[model samples]
Target: MFYRIHQFWQAIHPIITEDELAWVISLLPAPSLALFQGQPLPEQRHALDVAQDLWSSGIRDSHLLIAALLHDCGKTRYPLQLWERVAIVLLQKAPRKIWHTLSRSSLPLAASLQAAEAHPLWGAEMASHLGLDPRIVELIREHHTPHSQEGYLLYQADNRH
Candidate 1:
């Protein structure tokens, strides 16, 4: 895993400074760099790696990479926790119209279209507010939708060994 990370690190440089890089490196577990691949980086790093893969494939579209990186960032709230909270609020307080709106969306792992519909919007909204590029946010929003042809290609490239 470390070898892959080293390979990736050697290939793509971040937008951050040396000091920031050093700080990020210091925070990573020594073995984690070597042992964990792909899905193993800290949430942000995982996103970065995904973006790097997209870029390396000659996809110069930076927004797609940014979308790849932040796809699951909302998971920071913890999936179970957020779902439960959302459910409680919907059941107890939300208006019928709002509940109907929520019922149409997707869940991350569910096979339903609802799950697929939910991810891009949620991810894009959070990422854009965090100062991610507008285009990237668009990619994130469209990621799971049928409209995301280019972004999906980048995503597929990123996950392949």
Candidate 2:
């Protein structure tokens, strides 16, 4: 609960340091950098924190590192307000079918929920379109389900952020 509050506050007030920008530039290609920068500031900060967490833990696998940085880029496709973000998390308690149905609806809130739930798929597709490595694409795609070791590591790092 404390963490949720902290995240909410951070989402409402995000900061991106010059050091973080340098770190991103050092790691990402120009295309990926653009994609990363296109995200809401909070999401960009979250991605940097997730990637930094993985790198600090000595997980030098490039794909995992990159995936950690870009895992939530899909949120760019359907930018959510802070309230919408909160509602999506709360609504996760709904049945899977209902969630899917809501996501498919034409309503704005439903699309926001879809963006929240399906970001991994959307991010993976974006990565693939950018010619990212298969491993990186897979890591982004399976961030929630985590089929492999790197995927789990990415998932863990994302949560830590």
Candidate 3:
């Protein structure tokens, strides 16, 4: 996967610094485990479904497809189930209400959360450096926060599908 990403990275302009490579890589799904893993990651499946729906809607923008395919890529950086367990363990030492809030937070792993809002910037930089069209980077950056009618529609379809 890194090979593919490296190849793509080489084709684009230099936006992300060398120091940011590991940060960006940490956001991507484990390339090898992504396929034929014990179970398909829900986020990956959701992304694929979103991509298919977008494609079926006659949205020809490759940027949109790529964005939809990777919208939740950061989830891989965090393990929700593990955190849930940790939350449960911590709840034993805290109030029930506080434990409830923590459990319901649905927060990302520390590393993943650290990269949460940063994914867009990272993706934009990655796409720009990889020589992907600017629109593609924009789509990725805005996938979670659609700022227009078109973006809203895309988000709706992605969520609905």
Candidate 4:
């Protein structure tokens, strides 16, 4: 609980310095760069941190870096407020049927909840639209599942940051 609280606080005020933006731009293509910049400041910072962590650990796959930077781009469709994020985190532990029910209903946070649930697929679609590597799109889709070795690395790095 405390850890989540701390994470939420950090996310509420993500600080991305100019130097960090320059570093990020140097690593990404124009299309992918646009998507990365489209994300919330906190999410952008988080993605950059994840990519840097993977790089430091000797994972130099360009696709992985792209995946790390744009994995959460789908969240732009239905941006979650701080409370909505907290709700989604708690609701995620509930049964899938319950989650679906709430998400589909006309509840106040329903759209945000549904968006959170579907962001991975949405992100994958966006990646494809941008003509990103198929591997990068797959990573964005499967980051939460982590079945492959690369997926495992990304998942670990995402959790760490």
Q: Put down candidate 1 lDDT per residue, 4-85, tens digits, no spaces.
A: 5553563344344466445434433343222112222344455555655765678665445445655655443333333443
Candidate 1 collision pairs: 2-34, 47-69, 105-114, 106-114, 106-115, 107-115
Mark the 10 consecutive residues where model 4 has the least summed lDDT: 1-10
Cα lDDT tens digits, model 2, 6-85, are 77888889888898899888888778888898899999888988999998999887778788889999888878888898
- TM-score winner: 2
- Misplaced by over 4 Å in model 2 are 93-108
Model 3: residue 83 alpha-carbon error in angstroms = 4.6
Runs in model 4 with CA error above 4 Å?
A: 94-98
Local error of candidate 2 at residue 46 (angstroms): 0.9
**Best of the two (3, 4) by TM-score:** 4
Clashes within 3 Å, all models in order: 6, 0, 4, 0
Worst 10 residues of 3 by lDDT: 31-40
- What's the residue-level lDDT of 88 in candidate 1? 36
Write the candidate numbers in order of decreasing lDDT: 4, 2, 3, 1
**CA-RMSD of model 2:** 2.0
RMSD of each: 12.4, 2.0, 13.7, 2.0
- Give the winner by lDDT: 4
6-86, model 3: which lDDT tens digit per residue? 333432422434443343344333441232122224444455556667767897665566666665443444444534424
TM-score of each: 0.46, 0.88, 0.47, 0.87
